[model samples]
Target: MEVKQNNLIKSLRIQPLIVVIRLENNFFNISDKRENLLLKIEKLSNCGIKNIEIGWDSNPEWVNLILQIKKKFKSINIGVASITSRQSLDSIRSLDINYSMSPYFNKEIHLKAIKYNQLVIPGISNIENFKEAINLGYKIVKIYPASKLGVKFINELQGFKKKDMFFIGAGGIKSKNLKSLLKLGYDALVIGKELRNQKPDKDLKIWLKNC
Candidate 1:
């Protein structure tokens, strides 16, 4: 399948609250609860979650499922996991997704993914990764450990680069920090295990209120 981006720049302009894909392959027994969990996801969407993500770690079925889920949520925006193929975009190209991001953007596979109109976002830290990502033409940069770096880190980063280069902090984010992170001028950030854990909608409401 070939991916063609329609209004790609417009879609990328939004402030994203991405929930990364997490398969509970250990500890928690989710095998018998797929349907219920899917229901929960649907409910979350209904409750106004416009930004979401699917972390497909070499799984076509997962990508297909995410497509199906998207069919039901016409108003939502979705993104795929990071691409780190040593050979570049080979593996990511096959997924045919809207966006592809990762802790690293090795050549080849990444180039191929870009050809398909995938919005590539590479994880970066310090001057080296930032320069490399910009050189590679990735407008979005995921700041791996946002919690540790906080506002100070981003301020330091903007000093050297253009502020419009969509910056996202995803490693250790929580609902409590969303507003603060936003205030820091970060384009977006991911809520890690916080969203993965089962919690009541009321709790989510309270968290959002505080945020």
Candidate 2:
């Protein structure tokens, strides 16, 4: 687990941008939605995006979709997001995904992940949760709703950060603010709706190229 965790951190440090995709049940048919997602992932891959995280779903086919993605996009590192419950944790225990993330810290979930040997990065929004996460032996944590918390929150938390700890900024992150956040000390940033709402825009294209 240590080796795998180290490798994941290294990969994210190198690219520093994780494209998150959430498939919601909506008006569109599931087949069409899945196809569109695949196309978007292909586009991201072409643009040099190396890390991708798909939200967990209750649908039975969600497992199949993840497997299909792994087989199709062998070069991209895949992870699961929004892993907030034991059911969700069980869903990916055998999938052997690169990593998984929770929207907030849950001690029960974190302990279960350790017992299962799954690398589930906990999301933290307060200093208390941050400390708890560190005590739980997690070196990687997600600062959720990062835009809402702003750079100052991270800057203040720097005092509590241990050596080798990594922070992934997620929620409400836009291409325009990505670099600034990274510069402010986030190890990486997760871009979701803004990036998936359309094809990569000029700013994103340039950032990907530079990355």
The best candidate by TM-score is 2
With a 3 Å backbone cut-off (N, CA, C), the pairs that clash in candidate 1 are: 82-101, 82-102, 88-109, 88-110, 89-108, 89-109, 89-110, 90-109
Task: Give me the overall lDDT of model 2.
Answer: 0.88
lDDT of 1 by residue, 22-58 (tens): 5555312455555654676676676656566755545
Error of 1 at 143 (Å): 0.8
Candidate 2, position 178, lDDT: 76
Instruction: Report the lDDT tens digits of candidate 2 across residue range 1-211.
Output: 5666898899997899888888867613556888888998899889888999998997777898899999999999999999999899999987989898999999999999988889989888999999998898888889988989988889877889998899999999988887777889999999998764646888888888777
Whole-model lDDT for model 1 versus the true structure?
0.62
Q: Specify the highest-lDDT model's number.
A: 2
Against the true structure, what is every candidate's RMSD? 4.0, 1.5
**Residue pairs clashing, model 2:** none
